[model samples]
Target: MKATTRKIRDADATKARILAAAKSEFARVGLGGARVDEIAERAQANKRMIYHYFGGKEDLFKVVLEEAYLDIRNAEQALALDHLSPREALETLVRFTWQYYLDNPEFITLVNSANLHRGRHLEGSERLRVASRRFVEMVRDILERGAGEGTFRTGVDPVQLNITIAAIGYYYLTNRFTGAVMFERDYMSEDALEQRLAFNIDTVMRLVLA
Candidate 1:
């Protein structure tokens, strides 16, 4: 039993390292440019171990992508937005979304890579689909609550609201470099980010508020 436990622990640790390394590699160069050999070196695991655990590169990427989405969804769940007032809940969501993107820039790149392949990697990912459905339901609940309280407009689509909330932050941060050059301003400066967050909150509130 002791030996079995140790073996399982060691295997779990190795798998974690591989996942971390693969995330970094895939985020850095995307799926098409990422290499399994580099991932193995970065993880400090034997090459065969990766194949043994994850099957192949594409399969590994799928797992990594699923993990990424799950991370955000789990964090959102932990926010307990359901307890807050509808308006507060929506604002909190916008704030959380923006901050999350800022803190996890790699998530943006991984998403872009997935989009580049037209979400082929995400196909058949029931896990991701379930998480996304829950997220949409969360927003729908908020909208329904607000409408019931006469604090927000009725008939708003939760899916559209969710997309807008993500887009407001995602587009800005992902385009910070080109946007800075194009707009001739620093989108990532402390003040700029603060202003953007404020704008996002206001935008979302206006869309939902009665």
Candidate 2:
């Protein structure tokens, strides 16, 4: 039993290492440019181990993307929306999303690279799409409940509102360097970023609840 447990622990460690290496590779070189050899070296695992654990490069990439999506979705689920008023829920979601982008810059890079290829590399990603849809549905339900209870404005499409919220958070991170150049200052500066996040939450509230 001890031997089995040790083997399982080692396997888990190896899997974690591979995932970390894959994320770095995908972030730096993107899907088309990333090499399996480099990922193997970075993970300190042999090529066969990677294939054994995650099939091939494309499959591994898909797993990494799905893992990122799941991370955000899990965080959203953990927000305890039942305790917050509709406006507050919106604020929490926005803040969570903003912080997520800041913390998961690698996710941003991976997503940007996928978009650059027109998402061709993300074909057969129905599971990921379903997870995203669940998150969107959660937002929609919150809006509906809020409006029904007179806590939010009527006539707003939850899908559109959610998209707008995502845009406000994602656009800033996606264009941080360009924003810095355009604005003649660091867009990611501590105070500046927090101010932007606050402004975004306020803007959404104004549009949705005012």
Per-residue C-alpha lDDT of model 1 across residues 1-210, encoded as one tens digit per residue: 999999999999999999999999999999889999999999999889999999999999999999999999989988999999999899999999999999999999999999999998988899989998998899999999999999999999999999999999999988888999989999989999999999999999989889
**1-210, model 2: which lDDT tens digit per residue?**
999999999999999999999999999998889999999999999999999999999889888877877788888989988678877788888888888888889988888877887877567778778877888778888888889888888888877887788799888888888888888988878999879988998889888773
TM-scores for all candidates? 0.98, 0.91
Top candidate when judged by TM-score against the true structure: 1
| Residue 76, model 2, lDDT | 90
The true-versus-predicted C-alpha distance at residue 167 of model 2, in Å, is: 1.2
Superposition TM-score, candidate 1 onto the true structure: 0.98
Which regions in candidate 2 have their CA more than 4 angstroms from the true location?
Answer: none
Estimate candidate 2's alpha-carbon lDDT, on a 0 to 1 scale: 0.86
